[model samples]
Target chain A: MAGLLDGFLELLDVLLRNRVRTVMTALSVAWGIFVLVVLLGLGRGLENNVRWMYRDDAVNSIWVYRGRRTIPYQGHPVGERLRYTNRDHELVEARVDGLEKISSRFYPPIPDSVRWQGKIVAADFRAVHPDHRYLENTLVETGRFLDEADLLEKRKVAVIGVQIVGTLFGDHPPIGEWIDIGGAMFKVVGTFRDVGGVNEESQIYLPITTAQASFAGADRVDQVMFTIDDAHMADAVAIEDEVREMLSRAHGVSPADRRAVRIRNNVEEFVRVQSIFDMLAAFVWLVGAGTVAAGIVGVSNILLVSVKERTQEIGLRKALGATPGSIVRMILAEALLLTGTAGYAGLIAGLLVVEGLRRWVPENDYIRDPDIELSTAVGALVLLVVAGCLGGLVPAWRAATLDPIVALREE
Target chain B: MIRLVGIDKTYRVGAHPLHVLKGLHLTVPPGELLAIMGSSGSGKSTLLNILGILDGYDGGEYWLGDALVKDLSERKAADYRNRFLGFVFQSFHLLPFKTALENVALPLYYQGVSRKERLRRAAEHLDQVGLSDWSGHLPGELSGGQKQRVAIARALVTRPRVMLADEPTGALDSVTTQEIMDLLKRVNAEGMTIVVVTHESDIAEQCARTVFLKDGRFEGER
Candidate 1:
C-alpha cells in the first residue's frame, strides 16, 4: 500500500506537469459518468412510478364489462344493442369455483345528481356486494361497511368517500347523515378514506339489490368484478372460460361472439404495463452505457498520445533505476485519478441537475420526477474507475517495456 | 575491480548483422582513470554500454565484483546499474522538467534513500562539481557547461563503483569541454574508477591509460 501510494504521488506530479492534457482527459470521463447517471435515474423513476400506480388494486382481480352486438333483427340492422342481466351475475357468483370474492355493479341513471350538504359534487353510484371491501382494498374511516344482510333487506344505507365529508360537512363526520341521490334520501352508513386515487374518492357505494331495482328498472347488471385466490389457479382461467360459456348459452349469443363481453385481469395488465417500463429502463441503460464507452475511448486515445510524447523520459527513468513495475503503476495511477475526479464531477453535477428538475416538475402518475439513488451512483463510479484503468493499460505497458539504452539515445 | 574477457557485440540492421566489438579483453583496478578512443562505428559506445550493464553483449564475460554482467537477470542487471554503475551522456540528459538537484537525486530515489538525505547528498555532489548555486535551476535554464556539471553531479551522487561517460564533452564548446574534463579528473581522483569514451587524443591524454580501437578490435593499449 505504501508503494502504491508513493507511485500515486509520483503520478500526480507527472500529470500535474501537463495540466491541459490531464484536464481534457478528466472532462471526457466526467461526461461519461454524467450521462450514465441521468439516464439510469430517469429509468428508475419510470419503474417506481408505474409500481406506485398498481399497488392499491388486487393482483388477481378481473373485471367483465357488458358490450353491444350489431346483429340484424327481422329486416333492418339494429343500430345499438345491449346484452346482460342480473341473473347472469348471480349465477356466476354462485357457480364459479376458486372465486375468492365476486361483486356486481349497476350504473345509477342519475349519476350527476348526487349531493352532499347543499353542494352538487360529481359522483358515481356503484351497486356492490359486501365482499368488495376485501377485494378492492377499500378502508372504512367512520361507521360500519355494508354486509350481506343489508343487500338482502334492500336497505337505503350508503357508503361514501372521504371527499363527500370535506365537500358537504366541512370536516365533520358524514356517517349517519342523510344524503340525497336523485331526490331520494339515503343514510350514510360509512365514509371510506381515499384508497387509490381520484376515481376511488369520487364514488358512492350502494347495495346491489336496491341499485338494480331503483336505477335500471330491470334485474340487470352492467359489470361484474371477480377476485380469485391465486392468479395462476387453473380454476381462475376456467372460471373466466366457463362463465363466458354459461353467459353466452343463457343470453343466446354465440360463444364465438364473445367480444360482446370483455374480461380483463388487473394483475396481468399491471405486469404487462410494468414490463413496458422495464423495457424503457433497459433502453436507458443501453444509451447511458454507450455514452460512457465513448468517453472511455476518448481517454484511451489521449493516454496513447501521452505515452508517445513521454517515451524519452520513460527510457531515462528506466536507465536511472526506476523499475518497470514502478513505471507501470505511475501511468495507471494517473489514468485512474483523471477518470475518478472527472467522473465524480459529472456525478455531482448530474445530481444537482436532477434535483433542480425535480423541484420544477409536478408529480405525474405515469412519468416520475427525476432523482438519484445511492446504488446507481456507486455503480457509475465503479464503471468510471474500470474505464480509467483500461484506458491506461496499453500506455503503461509501453512505458514499462521501454529499453533505457535506446530511450536515452532518442532525440 | 572489473574485467571484460572475450567480449563481442553485434547489431541487426535490415537482414544483415553488424559486429561492433570482437574478442575485446580489458581489466581495470579500482580508482583507475582509463580512456578509450576510436573512430565513428569503432564500437566505443558499445563497449561502454556493456561495461555499464545497460546493454548485453552477444558473446562476453564481464565480472563486476562477484556478479557476471552477461549472465545477470533483468532485475539483477537493474540493481547493478543502480548500485554499481552510473552513466554520463553527451547530451547531458537531465530530465527536462526536473531541477538540477532533482535530476541528481534520481539514482538515490531508486536506491530507496530518504528524500532529505537524497537532496542533501545531491546538493553536496553538485557543490563538488562547482554548481552549488544552480541546484534549483532546471536543465533548460543552465548553460552547456553547467548542464554537464549537473550530469556529473548526478553520476557521482550514487557513489557507484564505476562511472562510464560516452562522449561527455561532445556537444560543448572547447572551454566548457575543458571544464567538464577537469571535473571528471577531479571525480576520478576521489577513488572512483572512470572510463571516458572519446575520439579526441587530447581527451585521452588526460587519463593514466588509453586504448585505441580500429574496426571491431583494439589496436593497442598504452
Candidate 2:
C-alpha cells in the first residue's frame, strides 16, 4: 500500500509538471464521453415517444376499414363501393391461424345520444364482440363487458365508458341501471376506462346482435380488427393478404386494386419504425466510440512525447536500479489518471444536461424523457478507461525497452 | 574488485560493423582508484559501459568480485546494477525536477528502502558530500559543481562495491573539477573502489593508477 501511494504521488508530480498538456488531453477525452451520453439519451427518447404513440392500441392489431373500388373488376364498375358483412368476420376468424383475438365493429349512421334521469350527453356508440376489450386497450373499471351470452340472447345490455358515467351518473355507480338510447332502454353492464383519453372514454359499447336488431345495420359489420400474437411484419402481411384475397374474390374486386380492401397492419408499421430506431441507436454508438478513439490518439501522443523528453532521466533511473517493469507501470498509471478524472467529469456533465432537458423542455410526439440507464453509464465509463489503458500501452513499452546506454547518450 | 578478459564489442553503423573494443584485457583489485585515458573513438566509453553492465559484449569474460557478469537477463542485470554498482555521468544526470535529497534517495528507492530511511540516509550522504544545506534544492537551482556533488552523493548513497565515473568532470570548470576530484579522492581513501574515464591527462594524474588506450588495446599503465 505504501509503495502504491508513493508511485501515485510520483505520477501526480509528473502530470502537474505538464499541466497544459494534461488538460488538453483531458478535454478531448471529456468531449468524447459527453457526446456519447447525449446521443444515447436522444435515441432512447425517440424510442420512448414512439412507444407512447401506440400506447392506447394493441401494437399487433390490423384494422380493416371500408374502401371503394378504384379499379374495375370482373363485371363490376370502378366506382362501386365495398361493405363488410357479418359473414366476413366468421370467415376471417376461422381462416386466420395466428390471430389472438378478432372483433367486428358497427356504429349508428348518425351521432347518438344517451339520456339518464334527464341528463343528456351526445357521445359515440360502438357495437362490438367481447374481444374488442383487448383491441381497444380498455380497462373495465367495474362490472363486466359484453359476453357470449349477451350476444347470443341479444340482450339489451350496455358497457358504458367512464366519461359517460361522469356526465350522466356523476358520483353514482351506473351498474345494473337503465339508460335511454334512441328511445330504447338498455341496462348498464359496466363502466370502463381507456388510455386513449376522453374521446375513447366517452364512447359506449353494445353487443353486435343487440345493436344490429335495434339500429338496422342489415347484418353488416362497418369495420373489422384483429390482434396477432408474437408475429413479426412478415406474418402480419401474410394474414392481411389472405383476408384481402377472400374479400376481393367474394366482392368481384380486381386483384391489383388495393384501395377496395384497405388494411392497416400495425404489426408491420410498428416493427418498421422500431427497426429505424435501432439503426439510429447503432449510429449514435458508432459516432460516440469514434470520438473517444480520437481522444485516445491524443493520449498516446502525449505519453510518447513525455517518454521522449525524459529519455536522459530514464537512463539515469535505470542506472540507479529502476527496473523496466517499474518504468512501464509509472507511465500507465499516469495515463489512467488523466482519463479517469476527465471522463468522470464529462459523464456527470452529460447526465446533468440530459436532466435539464427532461425538466425544462416540453415533450412532443418525436421525443420524451431523454436519459440513460445506470448500467449504460457505468459501462461507458469502463470502456473509456480501457481505451485509456490501450492509449498508454505503446509509450510504456517504448519507455521500458529503451537502452540505458543509448538513452544516456541521447543528450 | 573487477576483472575483464578479452572483451570484444562491435557496433553496427548502417551496413558496416565498427569494432569498438577488440580483445581487451584489464583487472583492478579491491579499493583501487583507476583511470582510463583515451581520445574519442578509442573505446573508453564502451569500456565504461561494459564495466557498468549497461551493454553486452560480443565476446568477453567479465567478473565483478566472484560473480560472472555476462548474458544476464535484463531483470537480473538491473538487480546487479542496483546491488553492486553506482554510476556518475559527465552531465551529472540528476533528475531536474527532483530536489538534491530526492535525487540522492532514488537508488535506495529502487533498492526497496522505505521513505523515512531513504530520506535519512540521503541526508547523511548529502552531508558527506558537503552539500547538506543544498539538499532541498533542485538541480536547476544548483551550480554545475553543486549539481555534480548531488550526483556524486546519489551514487555513493547505495554504497556499492564499485563506482564508475564516465567523464564526471567534463562539464565542470577547472576549480570545480579540482573540488570534484578531491571529493572522489576522499571517497577512495575510505576504501571504495573507483574507476574514472577521461581524456584529460590532468584528471588521469589524480588517480592512483592511469592506463592509456591506443585503438582498442591498453598501451601501458603508470
Q: Runs in model 2 with CA error above 4 Å?
A: A52-59, A69-86, A97-101, A108-111, A129-134, A137-162, A171-195, A206-219, A228-231, A234-239, A252-257, A267-279, A364-366, A374-377, B14-16
Task: Report DockQ per prediction, comma-separated.
Answer: 0.44, 0.51
**Lowest lDDT block of 10, candidate 2 chain A:** A1-10
Off by over 4 Å in 1: A1-4, A42-62, A72-104, A107-123, A129-159, A173-200, A206-220, A225-247, A256-259, A262-283, A361-368, A372-374, B12-15
**lDDT tens string, model 2, A53-146?**
8889998899888788999868778878788889989888988878899999999664488999988998789999999999999899999989
Report the lDDT of model 1 for residue A276: 87
Clashes of 1: 0
lDDT of candidate 2 over B1-222, digit per residue (tens): 999999999999999999889898899999999999999989988899989989989998999999999998888888889889989989988887788999999899888777888999999999999999998888889999999889888889989999999999999999999999999999999999999999999999999999998788899999
Best by lDDT: 2
Which DockQ value does candidate 2 get? 0.51
Query: What is the alpha-carbon lDDT of model 2 when measured against the actual structure?
Result: 0.87
